[model samples]
Target: MSAHLLTHGIIHSTTDPYAQALLVRDGVIAWLGADDSADRVADPGDERRDLDGAVVVPVFVEPLARPADARDALSRGTAVVTVLAGPEDTGAAPADEDVQTVVYRHADRVDAEAAGVWLPVGTDTDPATLTGLLTASTQAGEQAYLVPDGGADAGPAAQDVALTALRSVAEELGTAALGRVRHRLVVTHSVTAEDRAFLAAAGVSATVVPDADGVLHAPVASLLADAVSVCLGAGPAGDPWAAVRSALSHPDPDERISARSAFAAATRTPLRALPDAPAAGLSVAPRLSVSAPAVFGVWDADAVAVQSPDGRVAAWSTDTRAGTPLLPALDAETALPRWRATWVDGRIAAEDVARDARDGATPA
Candidate 1:
């Protein structure tokens, strides 16, 4: 059996909030706890990875990927990507070397049972088409994708359009159908507080492209302020760090979200939208643990810090007693954390060879 023990790191799991180490056995996370307890479970044949103060986080998910971006997504610590497949594209989506690809297509491309991915609908879609797609998506156990407006420059008008579109879908399809489909929105611009309330009530989740070039893209921080679930996407080839940073560096202080929160949006929130993904079963959120098909990223960070959403205090401390897990400093000024390794299904899919050699991490 392949076995590996990672120690001296922050394990961001709900299973054990203060766990500093974890053991992966035969591609499954068999044990995790404090660093001091790791030795009790350690075996002579297990490979050892010394994190050396690094932080371990669940691998990222790219929600708005395209065919062109598949190659490099895994190396950047994104293990899952929902690729936007066009009608002209033939055959199955090209497989990535390590990343899991879920195919997304326009509603007219194919029936939900055949397509298996979320059906995309827009403001321009006919009501009959929207109803059919929503009903098909519900029967197939998939969320129906909605893009309420032209991205980036859509502005405030987009919010109203989204609300109206969502209401119309609900009316035509019934609340039960809406429940089954669990609609997901791609919001390029801001959503008002009232819009947020309605969205939350309707069990909707929104995906935001933080790096969209237009001046009007809604800040992720603001989307996350209320109860509305928000996930981050920067297109297929966009940088995850840039999106995380953008969410953290909003110009208005009151609208800002914490680095940890922003990171979770990039990594964790997106997973919720992908309920049927194989990797989705890996995370055990309520317990704060992950199982086999274990996927995560290791980073070389200068310092880990705790942040508050209100922007009043920032502190650097790893004490588990603080009630919050520590994350790499992700503010606009701090250098982005350098990725040292990416573990997919408990295997090192990518790594900085020089750094691993220097750190004495032998291949398992």
Candidate 2:
């Protein structure tokens, strides 16, 4: 049975236009419209999330493959997540998120065989193991990710090495798409043309990620256009929202884009590179960006539902419902109290609150 999360007053959506209310099911937006219409069509047993005028946006997510990565992302505002490995320590679901892991990278770092089908193609890898993994995944119809700057030493995946790997595969099969080569890889420290070309020959694409600094630049920004997408780095500086801010506020005025486009770069734009990703989304948040003047200071913690593929929904809406609240946007401090009454998900889950017993042990 599909569920629903009805929100009214304001919405900043990508797929659906401004409406009084919308529906969510299986963690994805399912319907959008006015309150009366939502009431008329809503099936019984659907979850009614009144929000109490507080915002209710989709959970913002960050993609990664490590436990340490999740710990860092939660500090920022990454809500939902798409990770490569499940939690090893706390079962804590971040403040408003659910963890979705894919493959676990080896903690040992230098273990090339540990990479398996998702091969990290940098100089640090054991040449024989890397070659075998790539060849096997190619023949088995499984997707193989080429991590350029991955390995025990953690060196950037050399552009030359990546291209050479692809060239060998392409020559062996006479085509990049043949022998189970679907065309894709995951790169670190930005991407270069030769790397993109080698994978392109096999009809593969890549996801160009940033270094610890949280920046994804062009050619990496420009070359991997077809199937390439940028990640909001999962390192300490990795914040998807920050990634949106950066893309929207690119230093060069000529390169600057809209808040919505920056968001796409964080989530939707990466879809092309994620041929293996689920049809549903990862992390989602309603609009509360300083990038849009009207939405600024709103602190509308809720997310506006939107689909980047359509490029139609308003980033901010002007139409207002007659009885909407006239209250000022709540700050983080005040929001906590009201949350107790309306925190639909796990209220005491790992991160909501923690008692720091170590601080005042025995009344010291």
Candidate 3:
């Protein structure tokens, strides 16, 4: 058993935005609140450390990662990842104890849910079989996902086929039954306005990669405005922050997602896309609250702010009244905040070499 008392840091929790301390015991959060009250819950043997105003937020989740990129993702503070692999490629995925791996296999049809990840429906599946597969998965308490049949080059054609297929399945299942499953769609390209409406009406969650081949392929801001539950996915290379940056810095200001939205897409939103995630059953679903897994990243940033999607509003702000947790200022031209450390299940999994040496501690 181990106990660590982390004090004097910002906890990015909606439950308590002002929480200044967090207590971790046995790889789970035990308590978190103001610094003054933290001592009451602290034990003499607990390892106490002053956070010195660092920002602590839930660890990042890479939805469409490659197995070979797991180590790179982990070092950058992504503890939870969904790796898409072929049936034979499963063995290549990372098996690290500190990393939570969800493996989705690509096949002609929706196979059984794998050990950790949910199986995805292929585009070639017929409507009748697709309906049956989705219905069965829902009935069995698993929400299956669909990988749409299109890429950046397909433009509207790819989305049309996917929507048509899903529409047919929805008609067969009835709207309510289909909604109960809370289906997810992995979109590779931008969708038409009509398709976005259909996605919202069907209650389907969409995961989008903001950029492909150095160009913006999706209008993320427009999708969010239409009430679509959009999450960000960093394919293969596992650089989620890069995706977040691309979402924030789109050339078309009207299509740019805010820093808050972009950050959530890479972190909190991906968890909702996975029902079997480690944090799925937590009381505070998207917060660093007690009884939740101690999965979070500690970073050194000048300040955190709610960035406006509107180009007119200042790119960054430090106003406490924003009612938002402080995050690193995501200036497009500047480097992102320094990743100080990453904690998974209350254990330090990775740390910056320079910071470790400066603090006279061993690098994680």
The ten-residue window of minimal lDDT in model 3 covers: 109-118
Off by over 4 Å in 3: 34-41, 90-93, 108-142, 148-156, 212-215, 276-285, 311-322, 358-364
lDDT of 1 by residue, 1-364 (tens): 6889999998777557687899988776788889999988989988888888787877788777667676677667677776666676553344566766766665547634222444444455466655566656666666666654444344555445556667776676666666555677777765677777767777788887754551225656556666778888754237776677666666566566777787788887877765554435443231236554567788777766775655434664456555676677765456778788888777888888887687676432
Candidate 2, superposed: residue stretches over 4 Å from native = 1-5, 24-30, 35-61, 71-97, 104-116, 124-129, 150-157, 178-184, 188-198, 218-220, 224-234, 250-258, 269-364
lDDT, residue 346, candidate 2: 20
C-alpha lDDT values of all predictions: 0.67, 0.42, 0.69
Each candidate structure's TM-score, on Cα atoms with residue i matched to residue i, is 0.82, 0.59, 0.81
- All-Cα superposition RMSD per candidate: 3.7, 9.8, 4.0
TM-score attained by model 2 = 0.59
Q: Please give, for residues 1-364, the per-residue lDDT of candidate 2 as tens digits.
A: 4465555544444343345465555444456665678876667888665533444333334544455465534334343444443223333233334333333233223323222234545565566566555565567555555655542123454544655576676666566443244544555443455555545556665454444454444333444353444444333355444445444334344444444455545544433344344424423333322121110111133334221222223333355432221221222222211111111122212221221252221110
